[model samples]
Target: MRSIWNGAISFGLVSIPVKLINATESHSVSFRQIHTEDGGRIRYRKVCELEDREVGQDEIGKAYEDADGSMIPITDEDLARLPVPTARTIEIVAFVPEERVDPLQMGSAYYLAASGAPAAKPYTLLREALGRSNRVAIAKFALRGRERLGMLRVVGDAIAMHGLLWPDEVRAPEVVAPDAGVTVRDQELDLADALMATLGEIDLDDLHDEYREALEEVVAAKAAGETPPQAPEAAPPGKVLDLMAALENSVRVARESRGGETSGPAEEAEVRTLPRRGASSRWTPKETGGKKSTSTTAKKTTAKKTTAKKTAAKEADGRKATEKKPVAKKPTAKKRAAKSAQPAERSAARSTAEKATGAGKSTGERSTGAGKSTARKTASRKRSA
Candidate 1:
């Protein structure tokens, strides 16, 4: 890289000569303003107000306008003569934690290269010190024609410097926050966290300026005398009446894009209705529940019902087949009558035995009498039949 500035870093009594090279570059497409009707370039010219005529670059000089409308011509020689020590040197003020530097004050970044053989030792020393201490060096350096605050830190093996705006140059961020009356719920915060997790981390190096690429394509197509590719129409912005729904949709879309399973919190996220500005109480989730979640629930319910119906139909068919089969029959009447007659004969024998016992007969005599009576009754009945 070409060096933009050459200076020495004043670290206490140690002076390290270094060269400043820009650390970043832009690849955006540039366009020139032209007359729409004639395809002619519309260029701006420097002119003197007093002479009312265009002037050349050499004739133009910068001037500071005072409140009283007086112009004070300030030349480069005048600025060069100013007793600013940082004009040719990067003076180190202090070493501080890198976090102490406000990112909002950061501006253009540049890499510091050791100027010569003698500078190499000190440059490596400062870089190693910064790396070991995990700190950055606060510095003041002159670039262009003005002095600027800078932060020097180690980037890999080399030291890089970032120009910082003076503390006074950064305005206080007043009145930029939401209204004090507005509040956020825990549920909303949870959904927001889930959305963030769903999107996950990304490698910044993998990203590029897509707009620049598209612009280049258009330029290439026009140069080739062919029709340029039509840009896809952007989805129209919708009023976020439901913050929870928006967060859930964001998480779902992120998961789909990553082709991953839904995150735990994202899967468990419930649809909550929050009162939106200018929205009516009638605007509820029930009314607008036809979105993805509601549809998913409906589909699940339908699937369950279909499964249940199939199971019930199978059970009904089983019951009908069971009903068609014959059941076992009861015993015949004659068999039942014979079983009743046997019990009666037992009762008669018991009576006969008891009568014989009452008469003081021996047990052998009772048994003989009961058997004889039962045989006589059976023979008499058989004769009557």
Candidate 2:
């Protein structure tokens, strides 16, 4: 890349001539304004608000508003005439340890290269010394007519210059955290440590910009006059209810996913601690293959068995009800009537026999009129004789 500015970095008596070029480039895809239905580009014209008509390029002038709300027109000559320094040298103010610099205060970076063969020696000297000392030089310089605070540091074999933000430029963060009553349990902490152990160190190679990649793919498809494929639906992440449980599950998933991932010596030495309340979880690193192993799948299998047993119990209870219904049906109406009537008939017959035994007379003694008339009949026969 061509150098955007020519300058020299001076610290003490040492002056290193250098040129500045941008360190990074934008990877973003740019879009154009267009008429969607007509497939035509949309052109916008500059118009004057007061005149209600198109304005020429000469009519536009940059202006700043004053306290009285009056627009003060500014020109290119007016900006150059200001007292701000437009020096070609980056003057180093102070040298401090690299950690003293806040990453948030650092802005855009530019690559600093030697201006010519003569400047190469001093450039190499500065880079080597800074690398060895593990420190950065804070400097000030004028770029594009404005003064900028900067830092010079060793990046790889070359020197990198970064623009630092002014004190007033950075906003003070306003954050409110939960009260001291919020606490992290040791079990949760242990689980988090275990999860970290399972993860080991981050690999930059695995990092990707999925959204940009998909957008590029869609753009490519549209350029080829083909229908863009639908994007895959991402599953919504579940909220964590229990910190320890979430951490344990995360560790468990991480371990399972680390099929071919080998841990470095530093990570391999990490000893995982047990989870809360019990040692029933199969998460212990030592006895993982044994019965005491911590396996999420095993837990799920246990749950399935318990559910099956409950379902079987409910089915057995239903079967018992069906089985007892037939036993109840065996007592028919005729059998019930016979069992119930036998006692009643015997009682009635016993009552009749009791009445007959109370009187010692046969059927003849029961004829009351004939027994008294027998004497009268006998007297009548004697009178006739």
Candidate 3:
């Protein structure tokens, strides 16, 4: 246990410097308030009842009212200014028999040990002296701004301290007491004794909390992707017409359930199969390829290229043949511009061309063009004959 508080135990002139450590812990499961449907944490806000308005933490202050009924505010600074000599010291009040300290007065228990090497001697001395005297040392110390009344006693091989509750803090028994006239029969008492004696003995350490165990089992089933079997509905509790019958029935149940309380699963449940998850199982489609499909695609592409090349060659040959058949060229832009700029220059060029040609090609081709074609056709015919 780690020390939570560093303080000294002052008795007379001797101050045994020691450390305080809690000796007990609660293992009970804790749960927070939450919305049942959405599982959201439920929230609570502080509000002033008189003003009917939400209160901010900073606006709230501690106050006390006296007989005059006037509120007297006490600031945190004011509390800090008050002197508390026992703030870091547990002042020994008195030593009393251990029986005098009632269990009802105990609040929290903690182990107190020596703080350092120098304090070890004093710590041992206190522990040994308390153990030998068979008594507890009562002390008062301030912790977290509140003064606590505690008692020191020897526990096992070390010293332990228990913070006690004030007398008025614990409720009085007189407030709500059970029936005062209830009487017991000697035969009933004997039966009860026999029942208790007949019950099977169970070691406290061997006993298990059924509710906590069942809750854990449910959680385990959920984690394993399976549904936990539902428990059978309990029979309604019958009214106790006879007290003797009830006691006898309870004894019978205690005996029967002691050995047969827990049972094995009635039916096996199938677990859901999750997808495979690993480095080797993870990849993309781009990284996957088949050699056979790639080869077939390459072959088809090559065939298409060959067919296109053949078609292109035939089209180029036909275009060359049509070009060689001859066609007149259109007039150039410079000639048209020159004609527009100088009409005289255009007329002179036209007259010179007409004189040189003597005659122009009319409805059909010129006689020279026709004679040239006819001569070629005749030559071709003679060669064929």
Best by lDDT: 1
Candidate 1 per-residue C-alpha lDDT over 132-225 given as tens digits, one digit per residue, 9 for 90 to 100:
9988999999988889999999888889999999999998876676667887899779888888888888999999998889889999999999
Best by TM-score: 1
Candidate 1 residue runs with Cα over 4 Å from true position: 47-60, 66-70, 268-385
| TM-scores of all candidate predictions against the true structure | 0.68, 0.61, 0.53
Determine which window of 10 residues in candidate 3 has minimal summed lDDT: 262-271
lDDT of 2 by residue, 1-385 (tens): 8999886888678887888999988888788999999989998999988899999899898888999988889887876566644377789888899889888799999999999899989889889989998899999988775788999998999999899998788876655555567878776676667677778878899997788888999999999999997967999997665665566566666776987353322223233343678666666445552446557769989999999999999999798658646433422322333344446543443443344335443642343233224324433544565
Give candidate 1's TM-score: 0.68
- For residues 152-208, write the lDDT of model 3, one tens digit per residue: 988898988899987778888887888689888774565465456546467899886
How many pairs of residues collide in model 1?
Answer: 0
Clashes of each: 0, 3, 0
All candidates in order of lDDT, best leading: 1, 2, 3
Cα-based lDDT for every prediction: 0.80, 0.72, 0.70
lDDT of 3: 0.70
With candidate 3 superimposed using the best TM-score fit, by how many Å does residue 332's alpha carbon deviate from the native?
99
lDDT of 3 at 357: 36
